[model samples]
Target: MQMNDQRDINAPRAEVWAALLSADVLKECVPGAQEVTGSPEEGFEATVVQKVGPVKATFKGQVSLTDMVEGESLTLSGEGKGGAAGFAKGEAKVRLEDIPDGTRLIYDVEAKVGGKLAQLGSRLIDGFAKKMADQFFENFQSVVEGPADEGSEVAEAEGTDEASKKKGWFGRLKG
Candidate 1:
């Protein structure tokens, strides 16, 4: 699957770049992510749990940034395994541009799945991927922007309740 989109963050380009590289921010923003370790200089290892259609998976992965142009753009690539569930590997090219309002983050991602996850069909996987990406960006925006403003554009951009929806029906059932 592939995804390309952009989001405006209410922060300077440098600050947004710093936050994107922070392990703490990554752990908090990445959907279903449980932990993140290591640094941008080397690589980061992460563990995440996600539910897709009827499957629930815990994935352990390693991610590294390449083709970097500090504060401008970089390529992130990673691979993860979910035991009997499946495996996923992908690469994303992320770029930051200065906008009058703030920094605009543009990203293009290509990903593939295998094993049981592949059996779930492309439509389901694509939907799940899109949802996860939206959640990640929304979370990142909130974190970078700091505390909420009742009537701010950030608050009104997307409803909090919708963003917090259950990952999948199977996840609710399992819980």
Candidate 2:
């Protein structure tokens, strides 16, 4: 599958760029991310979980970033598995554009799946991926933007504190 997503963040490009580079912030931002570990030279090792249709999987993926152009763009690829549920390998090209009041972030992603996930039918897979992507962006936006204007509770369901960090779903997948 292939998808494109564009978002305008109400922050300077540099600030947003910094957040992107920070492992802690990225871990706080991505959806369904139970844990993420990395070193730039070593790439990102992440474990994620999700339930699609009736199938469920805890995917462990290693992501490598290449063709990096500082804060402007990069291409990242990785493979993730859901155990008996299936697995997927995909690549995403992410670009950032400076605007007058904020920055525009865009992702062009392509992915392929095998195992039970591929067997589930395109409609369901596409739907699930889209929803996950949307939630990720929403979480990222909030992390950068701070809490909503309504003064809502913090959305750290992904777990942020040292305690939660040690006990998070991602922590369980660390290797």
Candidate 3:
């Protein structure tokens, strides 16, 4: 499947770019992500748990960033193995544009699945993929913009300390 989307984030382009480079921020943004480790330059190792239709699996994956152009754009590619649940591979090309108030984040994504996941039908898989992408970007926006900009209780409840809460998700990550 292929998808394209954009989000207007209320932060400087540099800050958004930095957040994109941080594995900690990516872990917080990715839906169902249990763990995400490593740096953008070295690539990341991730474990995520999710249920699609009737299949529930823990996916072990490696994610790498390529075609990097500093704060402007990059490509993210990844593949995961889920034992019997199936395997998934995909890539996203992400671009950041400077806006008057903040930055415009745009992405084009393509994904494929095999084994049981592929057997679940394209409609189901497509919807799931779209939802995952949306959730990731939404969380990323909240992290970069901070709770002051978006005011999400869910963000607050996600185990941040009082100091970190006041600092904003991205700011806390910088420490």
lDDT (CA) for every model shown?
A: 0.84, 0.75, 0.90
lDDT per residue for candidate 3 within 49-166, as digits (tens), equals: 9999999999999999999999999999999999999999999999999999989999999999999999999999999999999999999999888766344455567755543443
Residue clash pairs of candidate 3 = none
Pick the winner on TM-score between candidates 2 and 3: 3
* C-alpha RMSD of each candidate structure in angstroms: 9.5, 8.3, 5.7
Across 1-175, the per-residue lDDT of candidate 2 in tens digits comes to 8888998887777766666665676677667789988966678899887788998789998988888888898887888987898898888788999988788989888878889998999999888777776787667766765533321224354353532322222233341
Measured on C-alpha atoms, candidate 1 has an lDDT of 0.84
Off by over 4 Å in 3: 149-167
Better of 1 and 3 by lDDT: 3
Pairs clashing within candidate 1: none
Alpha carbon deviation, residue 162, candidate 1 (Å): 31
Q: In candidate 1, residue 84 scores what lDDT? A: 100
- Cα RMSD, model 3: 5.7
